[model samples]
Target: MTFAFPVVPRYSEIDQQGVVFFGHYLTWCDEAFTAFQASVGYPYPEMIADGVDIQIVHASLDYGSSVHWGDLVELVVENEKVGTTSLTSRVSVRRRSRSDEGWSDAVTVQLVHVCVDASAFTKVPVPPRLVEGLAAARA
Candidate 1:
């Protein structure tokens, strides 16, 4: 399943060259990941409270184009893979002119997170609820 998260870059996020700074895309990816989980009833804080948490093991971004400060960025997030102790999420950064009718892919971000015991920070199997939620949320 795919989840949609929208963001408009803050003026501060733009670089001196007038395009969005490369670093901000990662922030958006993280936000989208959290939002996606919350949408699935697995909010981060609540998960930690339950002694289950997810920790990022890797993140990668492939840039295809530049996005200006005002462009509309729609982050298309979905679970790419799920394993016994880890999961991967892919986020497509779709950017468009503020008044345009269509979007173009600006960046592709992939994040891999491992499930862990909150207290011990040791790897653990992905929770069944998360597995079921991701299965249902797949598009």
Candidate 2:
């Protein structure tokens, strides 16, 4: 299952060459993830209020094509692997423009997030509620 988010590229997100900066890909991924969680009824604020926090343990991105300012991008987020306490999400970004029509994979990213106790900062099992929420979102 994939969650799609429409993204509007900002001028500040681009470099001098008029292409999105490499580091901005990570920020895009983060935004997509947050949107995914919210769509699944597990918004970050609610999770934090419940003493649960997810921290990125690992992240990587591969840029295949350049995204310029004003290009609308669709960020597709999916679960690559889900474990007891950690999960890896795959994010694919595609530029929504005729010139970049063939660029179905402008960027591909993988991020591993570990569920943790906010106060203790120790890894914890992902709550059943979250799992159910994600499952429902997929459905």
Candidate 3:
């Protein structure tokens, strides 16, 4: 199961060639992840307030097709691997047609986020609530 976020491509997200700039894909992936967390009642602000923080330890993306401004993209996210102190999320962005037939894959990305103590910035166990939330979302 995957968490999906709707993204409207902005003119600024495009390059001179009119397709989405490669770098923008990473930003959108992060945005989708954040949005998913928020949807599950664990937004970043709440995490930080609770003395937990997550930092991206790794990220990679593979582009399959070009996306241009005005295209509605759906960023789909799922847990790839969940470890004690780190979790890997797989994200995919696809072109969403206006009629809601669903999405067509355009790109895919994997990101690793390390859980840490906010004050010490030291690695910490993945919060129980977070783990449960992700599991439920996937289910």
Candidate 4:
């Protein structure tokens, strides 16, 4: 299953050329990921308090189209691949139609995060809670 987070681009996020800057796509991806985690009952603060931390080790974004200021975008996040110590999340951004209220693909961002022990800052097996949460979210 995929979780969709709706976000509107701020004027400052756009460049002088009138399109969103490439780097902001990653921020939108992170926003969707954070919301996805919170919806699944494993928000970042809670995860930290529980002694678990997930660190992004790799990230890539492919822009399929450009977006302007005030455009309504939906960041769709999915976690279909979970490893012993890492999770891969793909966030696809789509522009919402003003009339039809439909979405069109714009950007695709992939992130790889490794679960770690917060105190020791060492890699650890994916926490049971997180795994269960992701499973439940997927279901």
Candidate 5:
């Protein structure tokens, strides 16, 4: 994992089944991506200021288990791949049991973001600096 972002399940996010709603997992993934970028020192605002930005072109999730309302969930993030103008990130959601401190896989999500011109919002080449940043994060 390149970075970790922790989030506690809140009551407002719970569904009728007493588990975290399925959709919230996506939000957590997005938040984790933001945190990941900041960790690499190319936060969204800075990236934009540098005339580059990213937009999600696709996302897919596979569920292993449900996250309960009281579970301690952590999103383990990693940049899986980078294309000429796109990037793919893997955000693994794990629920850590408080009693035993063991983690159970909850969801695996792949978020593909395309690099774009900050002002035009058109496709753009991935910056070399960004590439190096991702590599650093991978370490």
Candidate 6:
């Protein structure tokens, strides 16, 4: 499954040239990731409390266009891949004048996270529940 989050660039998030700062897109992706986890019933804090955690091992973003202040951004999040100890997620950033209209792709981001033992910070297999949740989301 794919999850979409609506984001609006704050005035401070805009650069001098009036476009959103590159770094802010990453922030939006992270926010979407968090929301995705919550929607899947295993938020970060809950995972940590269970002695399991996910750490970002890599993040990549490709820009296709610029987003300006007041432009509505739809951040789409979905599972790209899942491994024994890692999960890769794809986030597509799109812009639309209204929710009912067509969207234009602005950026695409890939985030890879490795499952780890919360205390030792060592690699570990993803929890069964999380695995099932992600699998269901991907379906």
lDDT of 1 by residue, 28-61 (tens): 9999999999888788888888889999999999
Compute the lDDT of residue 74 as modeled in candidate 4. 89
Name the weakest run of 10 consecutive residues (lDDT summed) in model 1.
130-139
Task: Show the lowest summed lDDT stretch of 10 residues, model 2.
Answer: 96-105
Query: What would the per-residue lDDT of candidate 3 be over residues 11-118, giving only the tens digit for each residue?
Result: 888899989999999888888999988876678898898899999999988888888787788888888778999999999888965665766889989999999999
Best by TM-score: 1
Clashes of each: 3, 0, 0, 0, 0, 1
lDDT of 5 by residue, 35-136 (tens): 988888788888888999999999999999988877889999999998999999988999976674689888999999999998899999888788989988
Residue 90 of model 5, lDDT score: 88
Candidate 4, position 26, lDDT: 88
Better of 3 and 6 by TM-score: 6
* Cα shift from native, residue 49, model 6 (Å): 0.9
Candidate 4: Cα lDDT at 19: 89
Best prediction by lDDT: 1
Q: lDDT scores for all predictions?
A: 0.91, 0.86, 0.87, 0.88, 0.89, 0.89
Q: Taking the tens digit of each residue's C-alpha lDDT, what string does model 4 give over 8-44?
A: 9988999999989999898888888989999887888
lDDT of 6 by residue, 4-46 (tens): 9989889999999999999999889889999999888788899
Lowest lDDT 10-mer window, candidate 3? 96-105
Question: Candidate 3's C-alpha lDDT?
Answer: 0.87
TM-score of 1: 0.95
Pitting candidate 2 against candidate 3, the one with the higher lDDT is 3
